[model samples]
Target: MTTRTSRRAGGRQARQALRAAPLAKETRPVRAGLEGGAYKPLTQAGMERIHQAALDALEQIGLADAPQSGIEIMTRAGAILGDDGRLRFPRALVEDMLAKAAKNITLHGRDPQHDMNLSGTRVHYGTAGAAVHMVDVDGREYRDSTVQDLHDAARIADQLDNIHFLQRPMVCRDIPDNRDMDLNSIYACVAGTTKHIGTSFTEPDFVDDGIELLHMMAGGEDKWRARPFVSNSNCFVVPPMKFATESCEVMEKVIAAGMPVLLLSAGMSTATAPPTLAGTIVQAVAECLAGVVYVNAIKPGHPAIFGTWPFVVDLRSGAMSGGSGEQALLAAGCSQMHQFYGLPGGAASGFSDAKLPDMQAGWEQMCSNVMAGLSGLNMVYEAAGMHASLLGFCHESLILGDDIIGQALRCVRGIEVTEDAVDLDLMRSVCLGGPGHYLGEDQTLSLMQTEYVYPTLGDRTSPKEWAEVGKPDLVQAAKTRKETILAETSRAHLDPIVDQAIRARFNIHLPR
Candidate 1:
């Protein structure tokens, strides 16, 4: 009688327990700020050797084309202006600047929830590039990427759980004027997503105008300065150790205006940089070190990302092989170098060597993505939807890439060997006395959502079940997801008054 009563009461007790089992947080299975650094392509001695080489290069070879203002600033910061017009950083100067640089930085999102804490080996992967063409998957053709295409990409990226931030991924070909293009690009990105945005200015004067626009959106100059939602992707140096003078000016203005800057030093192997990977690394590092000295000379401890992006190319065809094994190693190697300096840094990864999102694209996209994460790249750019050696963007591919990055981040998360996680009780409950299967066990049910990651669109059904589901096309599925996301009102929508004021002031290209 007692046993029967207990069983009857068991239903009520289980119902209460089910109601009390907390639901999962809205956070994605694979999330931003996951710790990486598991894979080290370079040994300790190797990293140190590269370090000295970079230092020696900065001290001996130096860099050329410093604007007069830059020359003054660097000279003030103990960097010697050599007789050859090269700005030579003494080893002491670079080390001093490194010590003065900001370590952890917050890449703010308008929605505070989306801000990125960039410190140490914690990793975040997102999209970025200057692709000019859009791959029309259905039509099987390439066309100029318009302002509309760019806005659409940001909106889609905003909804992807694994995509952490929005970096201006494509050039707005429809807008012709330089100033107009700069303002519109920033506007389109801010209007689309509240996530931390990365954009570029054509020249230094453009930065002043862009900052004014940001002031309007931020309600005042102080507010904008207090929390800069966007960063300037300034390519301060040309390859092989030289400054792009105008971009250096732009970097100064961006820093002065209290905005963060990604000191991007992208060098191509067998092309703009040295042919050997180690040699390429040295050049890239030396250039970015010069950038650090440049930035610190402008303002001490200002937020900056050491963007040491080194790329590999196929030596024979003279074409970029962004998806090649060499490219993956180059990116991963850069990641290790970033950790060595303890600087907040980023590198390029997740590019497709294919013209379209094919099987080749899949392999190419994953190679660097996995390596970049495992090597602990702080901010992994171009980790999704970049194609044709960074010349094209595809909305469908961007959506699909979200699933791909989810798996990569899971690898970065690695395994947790906690007491409960490695429980002998869990094994015995099923094998010894109880159910003989883990399906009905309490631990199995409890750990399901927390321990395992399930892909949203990846099919897990049996062959017959998949057939019954009408054998749905994957690309079509991605297209449907995009349509659904764009159909909704953006979660990061700006205030109506602010939106109206912006439109009234600037020539808004994206229609309401």
Candidate 2:
């Protein structure tokens, strides 16, 4: 009995020690930099105004024909329908539903073992939707992607630090069957890489397959259900319209299965809706809300992200150009609408119609990136490497995008608040004699590292020094950075048996 008692005491001591030790440090802080500075905290009055605007648009003009189920739901909820199949949503009902939606959520990645926290100060980055081009290692460009290209792209994305999510499609590849192709692509990516995945497919069975793979990686179905691999299921809403049957079915499955989905609506001004930005925005909001209502109807607390990539149709060329000032305005409005629902907003800022990485690309990317970041979208998709109006993705463009995203993240970080940051006392002491000397001061040397962000790409050296080293352009610098990163960093290895099983299932031999 005495021996057992002593053993129990020792066990208690061990447990206590374990509890005392610090938890394994999170890879990054949950909330870094300034608190709540990045977000524009909306007041109750502002929400009411936005809500009223949405209602006015719905009631005055009414929305166009949505899916049959969507029409039925709106009718049941006392939303008025016109002869033209326009829907007029009840303001009260809209407000009530919006009140119940979850504003903040953490999206799980390839590993159910880890997730990207979205609330508070935490920010996650990813590329934008559906592109058709890819750039190779030897500066060669290829269009219309294949499975092999996707695999290599996933491998490269897995090795990047700033890129935290896989947005699918190195290029749309051909498989034996469409459903099988979707499943194989998703499986290949989740199995081969460690980053969070963002994918969208048209088939329910394909979704089920992707979800099953997520389950396997998560160790169980329940774990997978609790924190799913985040995906942005795209559904095209007919202009000034409602959801389609296929879209409704997809949204229902996602909700029923308790998976997070982003309701993406790409409304074009003048072509899809009205020519004016505000009118187009109101129309887009109604369409997005209609989607939200669908998801919420299927499951009251289903995880849904509100997204819009609205652009104006160029009157001259009839092309979908990405960098118009109107696009930025639409993005800001989308952010407001998401905020109204207390849901996370999704938008992309860095995209261009320029065919190459030139001034047009730089300006467009920078403008969009800044607008999206300032608008306070929770997840900024296409924050990197998009060109030719989002028709292409280049290796060099991606590297440049990393630097741009880092800059945007730094902007959101705002100003740091600490004794060292303020340095009131130190400044007073050093400046009391009127702009004297701080270079020789011990405090200056001690604090410089924490105060500055040393650039990985931007040139900080003198012009003379830069010229001596050949004065490389940003593209060359980006290329050099990508090469160095690929050479120096190693991809994280997965469990050997799991890896083998995945490859075997796909009937693809593992590269030696």
Candidate 3:
């Protein structure tokens, strides 16, 4: 009896030790660039039809209101500037430009370790949106989001292993000037995280200031150009096939500055686009294809993400239905279209119509995020913290999203079948003559950490244990974690000298 008890104690200690050990970067079960093409929502024929429809829309319908510069650039590259003031793309010209477009591009981060290889079906999830309200979970209230809130979100995302990139998630509502707001937004993101960032410019004139700020942060202009840690999330096209003229100009300047661009086409279905899901996809694809021609015309093979972001709307009230099942299908279908063209692509997901992070929010966010990862989206934007149809962002919800995304990435990782994984020697030993269970087996302990994923904030305790621990609420736990993270000093900021120089040169509104 003594010997048996000793053996049990030793096995328990070994299991505890294995669980406590930290996993190496390479050994983590889920990571940034896991491949995920296992959930194609469109058949080959359906995708082909969508592609042909997009081409038809571009060729037959065309898009209007291009700035004179864009008209000149595209016309020089074989686009037809119609007398109707629309720019039409020939199928052949589009094919040629598509040939010149860059593929398998890398989105560099300030820290090289965070670089994301956006090629094939590799998946990376991050935050993106222009929410004006910050969800105060404790007070159950909504307030305007400030630059400080943006920085705090970035700092929180920096500590999360699952959030691979940090895009400007909220507007600096406190800053009234558009140019200052633009500059401060970029500064806040870079200061809070070393990950690759995406931001937008209110006007084409502000692109120069944003570039200067990036150059200072990167140590020099040449260094910034080489890596270009930031990308412009340009909404170059207005819905239902028209150019956002100023935004198009911003795209040109951003590309010239050696920064990448996300050619975002966000059309609200049934309002700016067709009500049918397939029709919305077609319109978004067509608009982005026109954007592709415009971009490759400016600079052949310049890095651009084909951002076809079509949002859903509830017809009864004409409200955006960000958390609906239809929205998930829209994002997945758009991802498939990007795969069809062999270009890096992104789409919006993980939004919630609920005002708070409740049960409804949980299901809505998880369903779309899982589908987005499984559909092989290169960059999954707005994958966390968005609430109230994307009008609000919650820091606590963002922290909870890290745990949710971890699980989604595990699904993206899927199952691996190999000789060792399937070999039944250990199983046979346990079943036939050993302990009659695999709990204490050497193989069990070895594979435990590698073969499975554990959530940092999600609970998996038994009812008795959970009750014994005073029944901790998930939202409360997330709020506590958020507070702890923000209270801790962060090392993600820039060098003191460079920061001072930037502050002097620009009217940075954020506090030191």
Candidate 4:
């Protein structure tokens, strides 16, 4: 009887020790900058064929609607501006600019700890989208997003371990002035998080105004240029081989100011672009290549993100299917092409077709996210909290997406086949010795936080435990997490003096 009692007491001690095991963030299993590229959806020959096709499209079909400045830049860089107004790029010029394109780039965060190195298949996932409406998880309704909503989203993203950076995810509809909207968007994101930010300018002049504020935040023009935190997510092309004149002007200004530019070419297949997936990839690459020529012409070697974001269309409805399998394929395939060029690139993923955060959203969000990460995408944009085909942003969904991305990043990290991992001493000990289980074993305790991942808001309880805990709703849990984060979150990633000065000069919307 004493022997049995001693065994039971030992079991209690083991359970208490397991419960006390540390799971510190610094020792977590997965993290940003994990090398992905394990999943290659396209063959070398296929990538080459696509590349040649893109080059052929650029050389033969060319692009239309170049601003006079674009024409001047391209013409000086071996491009032919025909009488028909199509600015045609020579194969030589495209190839030359490709060589000049910045391959390895560092995306700076105001807090240096969060900086990401963009090269090879090093993958990082973050938020992006111009979602106009905020998904109200509680009310199950949508509302026009305000600047406060954008600021809160950034605050929540700041705390999410998996969300590596911040991009303008929603529009601040309340700010009517285009200039204020541009500057305030930067202020809101900067104030909310020190993570690398991506934002846009509606006008060229707005880019100047926004940069002035960014310079202030960075302490001066030189410091801001040395490590610009915000990259311009400029949609420089209007698909179908047409340059958006105003957007191209903004890109030029963004480049001149030393801000990284995402050469975004958003074309929807079966509508603006060709129907076939290959054709869509071809067009998107061709457009981004043209952007490269334009940028290199202005400056010999400038930082630019090869953003070939093409959305798949639901033919039956003639609407963009951002969460469709086809969209996933397009993003993954484009990532392969980025590797082909040996340049830093971005493509869209982590979007859901569902209007709400349901099972449908779960499947849709994970599908593209895993595929994009495994394909070795350098920057996975719009990888969280976007819904309704990119028209709505949900804060609760964003909170839950942190959990999803954690799992996805784990997939990117894959299995580390170290000799220690393969050693079976622990296995033999567990099978042969004391408790006949590995629970609380030395190796198990040691590897707990390093070899495994735990979700922040996701529940993994058994049915009995779930019931014991009141069977908490996952969505409600996410909402509660959101509230908790916002209540304790800081928008003071920026220095108080700098933030105060920004608010003093600009129409800063978010309150203290």
**TM-score of candidate 1 on Cα atoms, chains taken together:** 0.95
Q: Which stretches of candidate 1 lie over 4 Å from their true place?
A: 1-28
**What lDDT does candidate 4 reach at residue 253?**
89
> How well does candidate 3 score on lDDT at residue 436?
70
lDDT tens digits by residue: candidate 4, 31-124: 8888999888889999999999999998899999999998998898899988889998889999999998889999999888899999999999
Query: How far is 273's C-alpha from truth in model 4 (Å)?
Result: 1.2
- Quote the positional error of residue 423 for candidate 1 in Å: 1.9
- Model 3 scores a TM of 0.99
Error of 3 at 228 (Å): 0.9
TM-score of each model, in listed order: 0.95, 0.81, 0.99, 0.96
Model 3 backbone overlap count: 0
- lDDT order, best first, reads 3, 4, 1, 2
Which 10 consecutive residues of model 3 have the lowest summed lDDT?
A: 1-10
State in Å the error of residue 77, model 1. Answer: 0.9
Q: Which numbered prediction scores highest in lDDT against the true structure? A: 3
> Top model by TM-score, which number?
3
- Model 3 lDDT per residue over 1-512, tens place: 67557767777898899888888878899999999989998999999999999999999999999999999999999999888998999999999988998888999999999999999999999999999999999899999999999999999999999999998999999999999999999999999999999999999999999999999999999999889999999999999799999999999999999999999999999999998999999999999999989999999999999999999999999999999999999999999998999999999999899999999999999999999999999999999999999899999999999989999999999999999989989888877876676776777788888889888889899999999999999999999998899998765888999999999999998889
Give the count of colliding residue pairs in each prediction. 0, 4, 0, 0
Write down the TM-score for model 2: 0.81
